[model samples]
Target: MKYPTFEDVKKARETLKDVSTSHWVQDDLFTWKWWLLLAATFLPWVIWIKYRDKERTLEILCYGLLWAILASATDVIGGESLLWGYPDKLLPMVPPLFPADISVIPVSYMFIYQYTNTLKRYLVFSLLLSGFFSYIVEPIFIKLEMFALHNWAHTYSFIGFFILSLIPYYLIKKLTIKK
Candidate 1:
């Protein structure tokens, strides 16, 4: 079997990228699901802005940024590993479900961090939030044909969500500069 050359692999990748772009334009762009995804991408930030703690805005935003990084990275890994996928995309150039990674996950956890003042409260709320994300939101996405899971399950997602929310909070708590 002849292995493809680097240039050949690059050419194939470009072709696949074009296919994705074309598919997005033809099948995804401006569809109802696309509109929903667009709203999901932006609406949370609006809500967050309205509700986020004014005094702790910077700290909350930092936690959100960290969660976004972790969520986006994990989504990329999961997609690449064929553990899950998004059939419809708001933008083909991004991770399949960037609205979730970039907006929903971060915003939800940021709110939890902002509202939950004690470690016990944080843990309880975060666990509940993770369960909601894994069991409720994910199923809704699957029903809408937005997301699919292959080599994964809701339990795994629950664990991932829990860790993703917890790590950032602890890191922020540890690193915050006392005035």
Candidate 2:
């Protein structure tokens, strides 16, 4: 029933950090996942170049960073909890949450946010994208062995990703006037 103090949380994070960093660098350096990771790495910049002048810098920053933080946190918790995992990693120097969390999810949501003007439109588009990721892309990743689902499924991803994409839009609205 007791909550962890800041020091308790910090100590736990430090331990997890050391363990995860060691395992990643020593056991998972520069392999095939790294190559896929390299591609995942460049993909956001490519998308950014395409949309660079389309939106204000502050809008882009808030939208992208909020999603990135949420996605990374969830992916880490999911993986560390053994609910699911990205057994094949892209970046060995860091945590294994970046390929989708840092790159795909945020960028994908940013695109959805950029185009849609109304909540109705955003929700519809987000639902479609959620289905695409859950049903299409995730299954493809499963086939390619890029992703794994132990106790999780694409259906869960469908629901989770949809909510993930949608919540930030309203949050951003509350925070700013799209500037």
User: Which candidate number maximizes TM-score?
Assistant: 1
Off by over 4 Å in 1: 177-179
lDDT of candidates 1 onward, in order: 0.94, 0.79
Quote the lDDT for 70 in model 2: 86
CA displacement after TM-score superposition, residue 152 of candidate 1 (Å): 0.6
Show where candidate 2 strays beyond 4 Å: 1-28
Query: Where does candidate 2 clash, by residue pair?
Result: none
TM-score of each: 0.96, 0.79
* lDDT, candidate 1, at 27: 95
Give the alpha carbon lDDT tens digit for every residue of 1-179 in model 1. 99999999999999999999999999999999999999999999999999989999999999999999999999999999999988899998988889988999999999999999898999999999999999999999899888899999999999999988888999999989587
Clashes of each: 0, 0
Cα deviation of 9 in candidate 1 (Å)? 2.1
* lDDT of model number 1: 0.94
122 Cα displacement, candidate 2 (Å): 0.5
